[model samples]
Target: MIRAEIVKLYKTVHTWIGVSCGLALFIAFYAGALTMFQEPIARWASPPAVGVEAVSLEDAPRLLELVAAAYPEAREEGITLHLRGHENEPARVTWVEDEPHEAGQPHGHVHWWATLKPDGSLMAKQEEPSDLAEFINDVHMRIGIPNPWGSYFMGVVSLLYGVTLIAGVIVLLPSLAKDFLELRIGKNLKRMWLDAHNVVGITALPFHLVIAVTATAWGFGVPLWSAQESVIFGGKQKIAMAHDLERWRAPPPTGEAGAMMPPSQLLQRLNAQVPDFEPKVMVFRNFGDKAAAAKFAGAERGYVGDTRFGGVILSAVTGTLIKDNRASRQDLDRRVGTVILALHTGEYGGITIIWAYFFLGFSGAWLFYSGNLLWIETRRKKARKEGEVEQSRSTRLLGSATVGICLGCVAGLSLTIVAAKWLHGRVADLDAWHAYIYYAVFLGSITWAFAWGAARSAVHLTWLCAAFTVAIPLTTLLAWAFPMLGMWAHGSAATVGVDIVAFIGALCFAWVATATAWRVKNGPADSVWSIRKAEGRTAARQSVAIAAE
Candidate 1:
């Protein structure tokens, strides 16, 4: 087939894909970029909920007693233990139970937690729902809808993003060699836009492709498997849900009361026995009972592999060994899960990976924006050449769709963050405030998308997003300027981490706005909302020359 033939097929598929999933893709990528910083942002938004006092292994028993007394159901059901006293991550005890609610549903299961008080009592405050983080996550996951549907929608979007990525690279393969230092501008704006889009799309191919495939797999993995398994073979939903829940398991406690060694003693033993690892959490199940076993799990920080370390359960009283999660070295699944979380959450390599993901996220945003630009450029040239006073319906609609969808994400995020800050003391329902902000911004952005031209909307909303995004961290920092806000500060690494990240994010967005403004300042004859118009002519000529090649 001729090159034009390939281009034609690609153009048709690409336009359809973009037109169909462009808004969804824009929300996913834009929100995902923010989701990368979910933890830090959550920490930043909520005041420290746990204390960092180091609890001696000896005192864990007393603390456990208080926790049992405080939340008996949680104690009887299951509780998580944290032993790392590092500043970034304070130690805490958490118990989960169907926290009784008026709705008679177990939706808000109380994740009761408490930090180790210096006096040995649990010292934890109820963790507030983090609005901004949750909102961003909802956008990434399912646009905040209920399960299966949200997951299903996200799954489809992820698949579309994957297809578009693959098809894009295929279309760019022929022009891969010639364009190096090229971001063309000037006459035949459509071709220039096409070339620019191709360059960014091709250059960021690896990043987008990796995220697309992984995300789609994550989104639809279980759903597709379940559908196929149920349709083709004898399978059940109960089995699948059970399998999912099995990763979270705890041994049933024995009611028999027997003399058990203190948790402090057990910790001493764990340190002596597992000399190479550092304990993170110790769980004493069936405490003071015949079936009691104390498991010591830690982070093996100095190792090449996963940071997670397993535990050896003892008879609490007899100090007899029970089991080791890492004894067979087959605990790779748990570790794999951790690494995947680290990848998605920017936790593994610490701040370096975190910053890398941040910029890559913005670059991801730009990748989509340039695609919208190419759409406009391609259509505009035809309209101009035909001496048609106006663009066709499809072009107008595409432009509106692009502006509404992409800019809506930015606007929604801005409004959400602002609501987070403003509703701190006012609203009883913070999550509701966040939802309202998102819904309102999103709806308003769509209206703007249709009302304002895509170019105008992109420029205007981007500037607005820049301002709002900057305001969030800055307002927190400015609130810091008062010094009283320091009272809200804690030794928790998560809290400090959140504040620092917000400031850094603000600076980065400032850079984005400044650069975009400069580009707009220096461009061609016929562009309305951009400054890079000068590169259009050279870009168009080169594109034709290559096509003729």
Candidate 2:
């Protein structure tokens, strides 16, 4: 009996925290799950362009010479050699040119791409690719808010989210074993929802905790770093920071003339030296100079944190190893930090881990979504006990907001992803159109939810989400069916997989829409989530009795 009171107290705390932060978590987790396949989504959005073949190891020397002769500044700023060519990447070499701003801060910069011509001359152009993947990533990181403020806001949400997790677990401890997998489906709608919510929340508790902690750390990293520098590091802060940065820096070039080794030779040398190193992108600093160095950044397979800048640096001229920073090369501090980041981002363990994270992310989204539904149902129970014909104004308002924000995120992300294909060449500024498409649909959903109330809007928005998600696959099929539209499949498995997953997602949304419509029309009439209104006081009590039965 004494333990029951403690559980009840925490339950109230859990409910408040979950209701307050559930919407944000829904947005973050849903978008974050999609972000697991960012590369595939990027390929799906990219239009056909002239593909630049990977520069041959032997021919890399000539390409380097041409770039050096054409852009002298590139010798200092560094140039990246593409290892794998795709529709989005049209150049063998790429670099950024900084654009100066009045405020003396880093502003917009131009991206330059270059390839070797048939006659051995360099062909270069300024390029802009669709930023669909990046936009989704931003939404996941900040829940569609802009910079520093967004980060701070998410940090606060994450902290609260952690507190809620603890409270929820404590409340569930007394009955966890008895109801861990229970999903009681009956006229008692609140009980059923609570069961589903508990299942997801508990099953994926570890994943949520990791995300909560890591998200807080990332969102507040700048402030935390500053505080540590000021308080802990103190006089040695600058020296320590410089030392940390130096480990990742490439050696500067010597001015003396020297012949650069072919890229193939460098690759072979790197493979021979590290044996476990797999080079993905090679960066050459101060090309053509005697002391020119190359940094090969790639993963050491089968290791956590392997993808985070784990490779060796070598002399571009002599093909000799200069610095080893492979996956296993990190010190204790960096290794732990990188592993935490990797776990949060799902950056390691290959394709299998990616799919696992993908599903877990969606599950997290569902947990918060069901949580909101439970809140509405709980309020409805209270109103019913009081013999009220309708749920309270606050309950109705929360229901509307919950449906609006959650479904808005779902439908908005789907439509924006669909826009990736439709708006590519049709718009003068495709990048801006991405934002326009998302916000228009998002705000439209929210406005609709508030205007029409939760019951009616829930059905409408679910159908809309189904339609938009279905459009993703239909767009691909239509592109193939009508070649005259100037869109064609890239014939890669990645793009094909995107269309397949989207089709499955559409089916899921359609099922949810059907289920929600049935519940709204036929479920408890006194509930804010129900569409059927009571004719009179007697009818309302009868309706409540019928629902309770």
Candidate 3:
């Protein structure tokens, strides 16, 4: 058993770490949970005009040739053929181009799509796909901080998060057994919050640890890899790194043009070699060249690896297997790395694990939120014992900031998602509008929270969050209800599932808003959480002035 003094030391460490990193972690967890359904969200936000029938596998070669002939630059940069052409990924062929950089700005890129018209003619359009899903993923990865610097900042936060986890576990070691299942929701608000936070944190400890390690690795992976090359590999760094990256390299195209085989034939050959292989994306390199190559990337069920180095590369011309990296055929090193990635992504366990991770992510968010609440409540109680009228200015300021940031994140994401349908064809640059809408709402929420007190802002913002979230499902339902309105159901199970889940989310937000408004009206007058306290103080001061007169 650990000694009492050691437990006290750990408690301090845990408290400080949790409080300091709580808000950022909250953003990460909340955004990360939504990312678990990244593909579904993408489909829901995409405009219907972008949807098109996927080119048949046998006809894919013709489409490829047409695209290459029409856009010569694609011959060099390559093209990606989507095997699963759902509404979200409606186009059969896609490619990217680097956006030209300005004198003072960094470089960027855009996506281009090629589709077959009903008349069997090739049509290509340049568009920036709805990046709402990727935006959320970015928020999760770096808490919405801009890249380079944001990644490094999150890396440090991730390392400290790991330490915080260890300290929390140690502090709870003594009463863990007795209170493992305890959730005392009663008059003592602090105890209730402590119990709730402990329950979620302890139960999801393993998940939290995995998240911390993986987040740290991703955030700092570049620097760590560079250091490893310079320090450990020494003079052989280039050779060592090249050897590792060799598995991913594709052969360059020969200058001579060559006829390409149909993709169906190539896919058939891949399946013959690896029966369990299911290809989702087929990438062609150096189209219409003698040395052209294609890689069919997909996943095998019941395996730890998803798609990375888990499929076969083939000769696009001869339909011969060039390299096999099938899940069952991987070397030990590749297998280990694939397993780590699979576990971190929860990609192995199918839909069940996806749902499990979804809840775990939200619970992780709740854990951080509850930690903040506990801090505020603890300070309030202390000030009361000291016979003070209010808590410290810092505490009040933190309360307002937390309310603003947290609610802003929630409402911003919801409102931006709603804009996907409302602004699709009406705007010239829909993708840019998504970003503008999100930032405006997010910044506006912060301003409101600071202008109004925490108690009032919390109630109003919670309702705003509910309304916007509800709009998501309502938009789809309205489309279904009125077919002439140019809105219609996507008809895919994925899109339907997204709508259903969003409706449920709306209800949850509404419930929280109701509860928060009640707390503002009826909760303890000594706390900043109760708006009644401020009103009562004002009324008392007015009466005292009248009596003195």
Instruction: For candidate 2, write residues 377-450 as lDDT tens digits.
Output: 88888887887677788888989998898899989999999988887778887777887888888899999999
Candidate 2 Cα lDDT to native: 0.85
Query: What would the TM-scores of all predictions be?
Result: 0.78, 0.94, 0.93
Candidate 3: worst-modelled 10 consecutive residues by lDDT:
47-56
Worst 10 residues of 2 by lDDT: 49-58
Cα deviation of 42 in candidate 2 (Å)?
1.4
> Best candidate, lDDT-wise?
2
Please list all clashing residue pairs in model 3, or write none if there are none.
none
Per-model lDDT: 0.64, 0.85, 0.84
Report each candidate's C-alpha RMSD, comma-separated, in the order given: 6.9, 3.1, 2.8
How does residue 409 of candidate 1 score in lDDT? 75
Which scores higher on lDDT, 2 or 3?
Answer: 2
Model 1, 342-391: lDDT tens per residue? Answer: 45445445456666877777676777777777766666676678854345
Candidate with the larger TM-score of 1 and 2:
2
Q: Give stretches of model 3 more than 4 Å off.
A: 49-54, 99-107, 482-488, 536-549
